[model samples]
Target: MINNFIKTCAQSKLSSIYEELLDTSKQALAVNNGNIAKWESAIDELKKHNKGGVNYQPPYININTSNSDTKLIQQSLKKLTPWRKGPYQIGDLQLDSEWRGDMKWDRLKNHIQPLKEKTVLDVGSGNGYFTYLMALSGAQIALGIEPFLLFNYQFMSIHTLINNPPNAFVLPLKLEQMPKEAVFDTVFSMGVLYHQKDHLLHLQQLKTLLVDDGELVLETLIIDKKHGKQIIPKDRYARMRNVWCLPSTDTIHTWLKKVGFKNIKLLDITKTTPQEQRATHWIGNNTQSIKDFLDPNNDKLTVEGLPAPLRAIFTCQK
Candidate 1:
């Protein structure tokens, strides 16, 4: 499948970076894991239920078909559970994932540039949910780069069910692994910046991948400026150990200016809600989510005494 992606990209303006991406993806998939085989098997099962095609069904990326074995489809999809980033629907089966992804889409859809016929790069695209949306919006190509092998398999499972999947593709690679190129017309880095140990470097990398005047859509955790310039969590923020930094919206604007972004615009500042991210049966053994991570006495703060999950969306030109 990846080989076919490389070939398909070779005929486009992205041919220069295809070889590097192919190499990085090969190395990522080579890692051994107990779940790899299981995810692959589940994906194989999903392939059997392919129909004519799929269309963007608003909150649900619905596959269109006259008939389907819904029972088998549900059972097969169950094997790859703990869905974190979607609330998709396949025919009659509603995959009410942990996160209501459409809510995030609705927040920023009207504020950004149109994606039609543009090459888009989605950094840290979990399971290619938004990547699929980008293609649905008529992007020439929407390429998602996710390091997790399981998520890549999850992407394939969804891809196989569609007869002629859109130009969306997910590869097992990170922003750092991508070959330096200014090919993408738009770049998105959502729910990824706080996890980066070096936030500036991540911003720089995002800038490098876009063409001049290309817009960047950045969404990440942020704190109120009244709480101070920023907060570096002592151990964990909302029980997430990898969270390194949470900047104020003002601080984020300063960072963008320092990085040479022009015409920066703060789009939205919204606190995450229980309806948006909560524990669900699909979240596997560890069903904990935002509710569990927050302080029982105070929903405004996390269990660790830091500010609760508040995210900001910003757009700027390179």
Candidate 2:
């Protein structure tokens, strides 16, 4: 299984580096159960050859002895619920509106019942809004893993209120950095997988974190239609230059099946307005030119004039 997984990864020309890391990970898993000291030695050797960004660090939190300051911070977070925006809010950072509305609390509750007495993992849990919601919904324990430093602190403080709140621990690490022993009954990832350069590796890591028959929820952007020759958004890739892979529905479905996810269901709930009105929101003299291509009645937006726009929400059993 490991060999086949590696081969599949290698087949994607853009993901060869990740494939090598996956191969090394299999070796680490083999020795991980044998000798602790030997495993550390092997890991050190692998680090020396870490040409790819595949090597992941362990997740951890920072602590200070200032009790009064920490308490004040925690209190501030407690008073800030019923947030109107998405899971993130620090000074003035925010994601798109579609993300906030897609798989929202009302919709999410319908898909997943109250997680009473169940362990849950919120992957990419920015600012811990959903984490707190899960706790309030009676989850036995909710663990959040967010890589962003500032956002992790916000989540940590808010999560601390759970009446022994299900270990609202926030680790400043990515999904791949989590310890193999950390497993959960339900895992949620929103507005995250699309940002990864190696989407397949991200999926596999999520699978490893799940217990038998666990549940997974994911939301991502998909290609709906093709537009010939489009320019890349300069601001989109500013955070991470490698986050450029946006797969079609067919491609993503196949990848999910290949990773062993069962009973996969894809739901479409996209929003689009007519080009003329869309152009009115545009700025400057370019408005007229941009408005010419607007087609509100069009079923989908074209990507690079070759593919269609198709955003989807996915749910499956791991």
Candidate 3:
């Protein structure tokens, strides 16, 4: 799979970074072996079944197959459960993920520049759900970078099920691992910034990787200024560790300005709902989701007494 991705990159606008990308991904996959056995086992199970054609079915990325036998496919997918990003459909099987990714996509799709024929980057692309969407949106090549080894395998699992997958490839690499080349016309950093210890650095890296005036779709956890300027979670915020900061929409704008991004615009600031991120049968062992993390008595507050999960989407040009 990686070989095919590398070969494709060689023939596209990403050729300049192809060598470095290959090296970085190889190194990342080499050191990240904790989930290899189980992930590969799941992939092996997936290969036993026949696949189908891929399509965008709004809330779910659907696959249309002539083969109706899905029992084995269902069992194989369940092995790689706790799906974080997608709500995909393979044949008749519904792979409902923990988060309704379509909601986020819907909020920003109309506001952004047209993706047709552009080279794109999707950072923190869990399972390449949006990556496939970008490819279908007509991006020349949509490259998704995710650090998690399991998600990389999950992407491969889905890719394998597609008879002729689009020009979308997800690699086990982080934003920092990518070579600093201004190749992408559109760069998306959705659900990624708050996880960075230095939010400014994250923004800076996004800027460095884009072509001049390239569009950046930045989405991350945010707090209403009524709470404060930002909330640096003490331990776990909404049952997630390594969440460094949640800035206000205004503060996020300032962060963008600090990083020298131009034409900044705050598109939306919507509160996450149970309907959007609820516990599902597919979320493996830890089925708890946003509802479980919120205070049982107060919907406005999290169990840790912090403001409930709210996110903001900001678009800017580098």
Candidate 1 vs 2: which has more lDDT: 1
lDDT of each residue in 1-318, candidate 1, tens digit only: 666576668766588988888887888999988898888888888777756477777788887754468888777777888788777777787877899899999999999999998889999999999999998899888899999877888788878777778888999999998888899999999999999999999999999999999999999999999899899999988989899999999999999999999999999999999989988877788999999999999999999988899999999999
- Stretches of candidate 2 above 4 Å error? 1-103, 157-167, 225-242, 272-310
Query: What 10-residue stretch in candidate 3 is worst by lDDT?
Result: 65-74
Q: What's the lDDT for residue 58 in model 2? A: 12
Descending-lDDT candidate ranking: 3, 1, 2
Q: Given candidate 3, what's the lDDT at residue 296? A: 99
- Tens-digit lDDT track of model 3 for 44-121: 877767878898998999988755668778777777877888999998888889999999999999999999999999
Q: Scored by CA lDDT, what does every candidate get?
A: 0.88, 0.49, 0.89
Q: How far does residue 60 in candidate 2 sit from its true spot (Å)?
A: 28
| lDDT per residue as tens, model 2, 47-152 | 2321211110111112212233333332344333223223332212121111242235544566663577667778887766666566546665565667654454
Per-candidate clashes, comma-separated = 1, 20, 0
Q: What is the Å distance of residue 70 in model 3 from its true position?
A: 1.2
TM-score against truth, every candidate: 0.97, 0.54, 0.97
